[model samples]
Structure formats: structure tokens, C-alpha cells
Target: MDSIDLEVLHACDQWLRAGWRCEYVTVVRTWGSSPRPEGATMAIRADGVVVGSVSGGCIEDDLIAAVRENGIVRTAPEVITYGISADEAHRFGLPCGGTIQLVVEPLGAHSRMDELLALAQRRVLTRRTLDLTTGAVELAQGQADEQLRMDGQALVTIHGPRLRMLIIGAGQLSQFLAQIAVGLEYQVTVCDPREEYRASWSLPGVEVVHAMPDDLVLEMKLDSRSAVIALTHDPKLDDLALMEALKTDAFYVGAIGSRANNARRRERLREFDLTEDQIAKLHGPIGLYIGSKTPYEIAVSILAELTAVKNGVALPAQMSVEHGKALAA
Candidate 1:
């Protein structure tokens, strides 16, 4: 599954190629609590077909109505604001009287959307700059830490893989996790040195590597945007990979196992050079407590925890399998 941004870009690409007039709308800024972030985007064809979203369904309806009425006749880009008043906020369904600023650009040859889409498909971090007056665009390599910025003359939006996940083991659980993670826009890679497991693995879009987990983890240079999950249930594979992963800035490092096994794993890690703080970062038994008994359900539980961490949501102690089990004891 494509990310929301990718979906919009792809819809624009198709509409443009089909000779349909289209307008690209991006959220440039927002005040108070908005449903979507500043860089969220959507594209509308002249026929009122919309892909992606801005302020959920409310703002999208307005944009679609505008496109149907005016047909995106503007030759240049323009900035528009919505929900400026309490009544307007209520009408637009913005929570807490939120305000949202948008950049509505009529698509044309100068958009350079093809180049942007290609870069995004390649998972390359790209900075796209759009001139507000001329509608001309410029593309350059972007840093992971770069953010969306708008000056009086232009809008610069960063595109590419903002998150990644490395799954240690191409087993059934990894397959389900990779599928969901892809929809979440994670550049997923599943590493398994075992040939038998690697041969049967057939998920598309996820990279399958036949290398040691530890070496793969180091090679990827795991950063804050990265996550590592061990599902192999093999000490030789998971322990080595986690040893290196915990030392890095990967936002989450987890291994699927029982609470007692996790404790044992920590003890074994202490046998190595890992410190207590680093060891504490490990998420063992690895998922939220949702009474998951099947592989797919377990994958959902794991992703729920991963998503909570990614969004910086604080999960109640009883929500976690390990913590809940402990509390029950």
C-alpha cells in the first residue's frame, strides 16, 4: 500500500497523463489542533475525483466543489486559508476551532511531478521547491531531518522514506508485519540467514536479505527513524542483531518471546558489552496485550505498539502483554 502522499502523487500522475486538468493541494501550515499535519496533500481532477486528504473529509468537499465550479483555471499557485472563524471552523469540521493554510497549485508541465514520483519510488529523500508565481519546480536531495518550509515566493516539501523497519526473520509473522508496515510508509527489510526460510518468503516490496542480522543492522546504519524487530525466536540470530541495534538510535528494538525468555535474553546481553540503560530499551514479549493468539493477530498487536511509540503515545501499563501479565500476577 502506498502512503497517503504517494497515493496523491500517483493519482496526479495518472490524471495528468490522461489529459485531465488537476489541482494539487498541500497543507502549508496550521494553527491549533488539526486532523492532518502541515505537509499532508491531496489532488483533485477536474471531474471532482479526489485522492488523499487535507482536513479529513470536510476540507476535501470544499476543494472538490471548487474544482467542479472553477475547473482549476488558475495558471499559477495560490495560498488559501480555511476555518478562520468559529462558524467556519464548525462548518469545516475542524476540531477546537483549528485553522489550516493550503497551497493550491494548478498542475502543469513545470510541476516536475514525474521526477518527484520517481525519486519517491526509489526511496530517495528529495526536496521539492515550487515557485508560487511561475509554477516552476526544483528538485534536490533532502536530508532526513529536513522539514516542510514555505517562503513568500515558494513551498519546499521534503519527500522520501521518513521511517524504516528491519525485521529479523522472514517467517509468517514477519510477512504480516511487513504488509502493514508498508502501508504505514516504512521501508521494510526482512533479514534471514536461513535458506529454507528465505526461499519460501514471497512478499513483494519488502527487501529480503540473506545475511546475518547483526551485519545487516550495522550496514543499514540504524537511525532514530529506524526500528528493529526480531521474530526468528533464535538466540543466535536475534541476540547478535539486538546487541548492535540497541547501541544505535533506532526508535524501537523488540523481540518476540515470553517475559521469562526476555529476562534471560537481557541477562545474556549483560554477558556481552551492553549497558543496563541500553538493555532497558529492549521491548520483549514485544507487543500490546490484545489477546493475540494467531500470527496475524500477533502482527496487529506488534504494529499497535510500534505505532504508539512512533506517534509518542503513552500506553497504559496494563495495555502491554508483559506489564499486564506482571500486574495480574
Candidate 2:
């Protein structure tokens, strides 16, 4: 499972390449209340096929109808608003009389949709610029500020960064962990150089890498939105990667271990010339203290904690195994 945004973009690219006319709808902005966020997208093919979503299913039907009846194929890239009033909200099934703004553009034919999709497929962040005048699209590689504009449109759309996750082991636990991570909008990779563990590893969409963990970390070039999790408890496998991770802006760096082991691990990292600031970024005893007894339960606990941290929630020390260790005896 690739990230949702990636999957959607991929589907859009595939639809375009199939020689079918496609409408790419992106939610640029909303007011009052909306089912989806500003960056939400939905792609519709000529046969009324839809992948992804902007508003709820109700709004999608209307868009499909427009594509089929009103010759929306010729509409070009334009901003459209819907459900701004109470009556309109009920008609469109938008909860709380909310308003949604959609920027609909055609796929294929000299547009940068395929290029942007390819960039995202390769785990690269590319910005797409839309010409409000002639409905032209250009893919911007490298770094530049995002810009959006639509001709007499309701919202400006800017496709943002892609999501990424690095799973530092190829084990049963890593398999479950990778699936959950992938479902939650992450481009997941499972890394393990040990052939014994690597031989059993099989995941459909996840990238499996056989490399030294630390070297792989360096090669990944993880950024702030990226995450690294060490499911392998061996210091030889996990420690060097974690040491490199803590030094980077990767938002989350965690390793699975017991309380005392995590403490010892931190002390071991201290010997590596890691400063207090760098060490502080490590998240060991890695899952929420949910008393998980099975791999599935443990995966849930880890994912829950990851989401909390991703959303900027402060983690409580009481959830650490150190706080609950007295009972584990």
C-alpha cells in the first residue's frame, strides 16, 4: 500500500495513460465545515469511475454528472464552490452547511500530472503549478515555495509533500507495522541485511532493502516528516541507525525494547558522542504502555504512539515501560 496521495496520483496517471478523459478534483479550501481537508483530491474517469474523494460520495456524484453531461472536459482548470448555504448543504450532503471549493483540471496532454505523479512515486516532493489562463500544468522539481491560483475559481490548489516511513527490520512485527504504516498515508520501507530474517520477508507494496541499517539511514536522507523505527532489538542492527536518526530532523526515532534495556541503550548511545539534545529525541520502550501481549497488539500500540507524536501530542512518561515495570516482574 503506497501513501493515499501517491496511490491517488498514480491512479490518475494510469487513467490518463489509458486514453480516457479524466477529471482531477482537488479540495483547495473549505469554509465552516468540510468532510475532507484542503489538500484532499478525487479523480474521475469518463465512464463515471472515481478514485479518491474530495467531499463525501454525494458531491462526487454531482461532479461525475457534470463530467458526463455539461461537457466538463472543456471547462479547463477552474475553481468551483458548492454547498455554501443551508439548502445547498442539505442538497450536497455537506454537514453543518459547510462550503467546499474544488479545482478541477484535465489529465494528460502536455500537462505535468504524470510528471508530478512520477516524482511522488519515487518518494520525491515536487510542486505543480497550474496556469489559470489556459489550464496548463507544469511540474517543479527541487525546492521552491508552493503557489496556487485559479481563474475566477473558488480555491487555489497546491500539491504538497509526500509521506514516508522507514521500518528498520524485516520481521513478523515489521510486517504488521509496515502494513499499518502504509495504510496511514506512509510510503513504507523494510530494511534488514541478515538473510535469515530477509528470507522470510514479503510485503507487496513495501520496499524491502538489504543494507546496513546506518548506511541505509544515510542513503534515505530522512527529513522532518520522515520516521524511523527499529523493530530489531540487536544493537548491531538497530543502534547505529538510531544514532544517525537522532541526529537528523526525522520526526520520530524509536526502537522496541524493555524499560531497563532502553535505558541501557541510551547510555550506550551516550558513548557514541551523542549530546543530550540528540539523545532526547530517541523514543524507546517504543510503544504506548498498553500492556500488549501479542505482535498485533504491540503493533497497534506502536502505531498509536506514532500518530500521537506525528500530530504533535506530548507523550506521557507513565506510558513508558519503566513506569509499569514493577508489575512485569
The candidate scoring highest on TM-score is: 2
TM-score of each: 0.80, 0.85
lDDT of each: 0.91, 0.80
Clashes of each: 0, 0
**Which residue runs does candidate 1 get wrong by more than 4 Å?**
14-20, 170-172, 192-212, 215-223, 247-249, 270-280, 289-297, 313-321
lDDT tens digits, residue span 1-329, model 1:
57788889999888888898999999999999898998999998998999988986999999888778877788999999988999999989998669999999999778988788888887788999999989999999998778899999999999886588999999888999998898778889999999999998777888999999999999999888899999999999999999999999999999999999998999999998999999999998899998888998999999999999987899888899998777767
* Candidate 1 clashing pairs, residues 3+ apart or interchain: none
How many clashes does the backbone of model 2 have? 0
How well is each residue in 23-74 modelled by candidate 2, as lDDT tens digits? 7888877888888887788888888888888877889989888777855455
**lDDT at 171, model 2:** 86
For model 1 the TM-score comes to 0.80
Give per-residue lDDT, candidate 1, residue 35: 87
